[model samples]
Target: MSTLSLAGGPVSWGVDFADATGNPPYTEVLDGVASSGLRWVELGPVGYLPRDPGEARAALAARDLAAVGTFVFDDFHRPDAAGRVLDAVDAALDAIVETGGALLVLIDRPGEERAGTAGRATLAPRLPDADWARMIDLLRRSADRATARGVRPVVHPHAGGFIEFEDEVERLLAATERDELGLCLDTGHALYAGGDPAELVRRYGRRVEHLHLKDVAATVRTRELGFWEAIAAGIFCPVGDGLLDLDALRTALDETGYDGFATVEQDRRPGSAGDPAHDLRRSVTRLRAAGLG
Candidate 1:
């Protein structure tokens, strides 16, 4: 059995992608995290919390919790998106350092609302090969910037993003450096994209610096509904309650001797509400039972 520190984030409660404007306040989410036995949390959607590093630090300190990473969704496919992407990353550095060991999570912003069974059929958005090269360059530069800030840069292959597919993930990983750029293997998205988590671990586990331990509901997964629609329908369920072969994934991580934080992420979007604390606690319990908590 391999043991790694378990963390939880605002996304666990739907206090996510849309940020504070769409969900509960930071303080409340942070409190929920602490109360739920999560020692670390992510600085979800940059502006969702107090922007100032000092203010952010104080808030987390008050709860005795810390920020493990920060998510930055940007239009990397746009030819001119690099500057804005770098700017977002720069803005996050101070707070990231303040939170300690926080990685700059770079996620490609899926431009449109991909919904329904059609959305499920097409997990990828159109990003030209030239644009992908440009994005890769930007990612390399982003890694440089993060290194300068004493933080790490992690590439997140989101389900609705341009890099949702396994081959896309492989290409990105091949272009980046294992020592500099890290991979944030989001289990739910990878599974949703039809990639085997255990195989991914065997292939690129060495570059994995962060993780989002999410489970896709087996029933909803087969429903073939669009990403957001499925998410809105409470499709990302508790660990053991879902279909992921977590034991196999855990064995893969154990083989790698993974020591980084594995934050239990149950994607909860607004209007798709439920008892998040209870769900998160259930995930923690399940992880512990699997010896990965």
Candidate 2:
């Protein structure tokens, strides 16, 4: 069997309530993940589960499930005097340490402007030079803290966000110490940002610590939709259902000996997981057919 651990996350079942001030509940999403035949799942959008480590652990235990990772979206470019964003990362790491998760996914919080008026990705805002340094320093600090806490920190280059473009990703990789920081290679986002997934993995596989195996539908790209609009328009499709040559990507991973959790994240808007459990099963079956699962 391959060393890669195949899994799925909340967004697959439309469970990401990241924009809401508070998460409504988690039973449906957790159960959905467990029942979808994925032995592992990620703790999506912090605060979706109980903040108390003990409760979170028990919740997963009850489901006979293991956590592969937890997503932490922080705006390093925007921070308050309260140090809340850093504190939130600490909280996420604390949960990961206690809940058997090893990867802490770091994403930039660029939703507000990126999803403005049209609710589409504009890619308008660029961080100032000082802010770029600020973001890198924060990532370094966060990585060091996570290292002390026993989890690896992986940056995700999200669409319509600060690090969406390939050049920006290159800059981030250049600025951060490779040993301390790695990337969550979200395949769909890479394609949406106009980068080839197989090529990217071939070049940067060493810096990859975690994976979100999402396929993309580039039809939305021609529409020039916003980030949220594209997601709502099915920018993320199932494995083997879009533009990605998943088999080729898997072959590349094999050559690189990159064994890690490959969580299928077919991102959808909240409450938009129409027949998603079936879609997830089919997706997994597709990956298995391609020697992925």
Candidate 3:
């Protein structure tokens, strides 16, 4: 009955594609994670794995990895932008079904441009009441579509993105009916935004569809790091080494019976400035000790 699945987002691995974009083949890393005791992985974008679902499924099966979910990003809240967003969601849903993954995560567009100071000071506050309402409407429609396909739609609140704080997250959750939208809580981002991960889980456990298990090493942030830098650094540590309270989080998840993907998401790849594999092992060990695995 333990709801834990050994899943991760390999995009965190920091692989350089050279010219190839999307998901870099993590067969080696997938082997590492599975050996480290993970059971599944939430694959990155489409090409990050094999473009063909059969190939992707075979690759996962070969590595003993279950495809728990995948992510998509488009402006679903804008009426004029509906076509692309809808198409993207449909495509994502098809992939999930094809690969036998159960969840679909929706991330907010990072902003028109990745302007750090200007974004935080200006663009963040400009979202009018109407825009938020529109977002909710889009969420409802998307949720309906996902439900018809039997794939859960999880709204991911991001840090460094426009709706990146506690208030914004709360507003987003409040705006939608619980059945139509669930939270894809990213622990590192929650900590960066000063929200208690355990508290959010406890308050909204019923609406949790998936989780991004990560830690943030605040000391490395250098104080001068911008939003992306913080996002790049502040949110992708191995499990126990950062500021995230995983033990508390586990207790909350256990009590709530959240049987979904608790995916470790470290956007930075291994052998970067730090040892990603070591950090990941430490995280898995910690989660095991806490009875969360």
Q: Which residues of candidate 1, in runs, are more than 4 Å off?
A: 17-20, 113-126
Residue 218, model 2: Cα distance from true site in angstroms: 3.4
**Cα lDDT, all candidates:** 0.79, 0.77, 0.71
Error of 1 at 31 (Å): 1.1
| True lDDT of residue 12, candidate 2 | 79
Estimate the TM-score of every prediction: 0.92, 0.90, 0.86
The lDDT ranking, best first, is: 1, 2, 3
Instruction: List the lowest-lDDT window of 10 residues for candidate 3.
Output: 114-123
lDDT of 3 by residue, 4-48 (tens): 776765655664231244333467667667777777877666556
Stretches of candidate 3 off by over 4 Å are 15-23, 76-80, 112-126, 220-224, 231-235, 269-271
Model 1 error, position 181 (Å) = 0.9
- Which stretch of 10 consecutive residues in model 1 shows the poorest summed lDDT? 113-122
Better of 1 and 2 by TM-score: 1
lDDT of 1 by residue, 58-126 (tens): 899999997887877787767787788888888777668766856888887665643233225354445
Candidate 2 accuracy as TM-score: 0.90
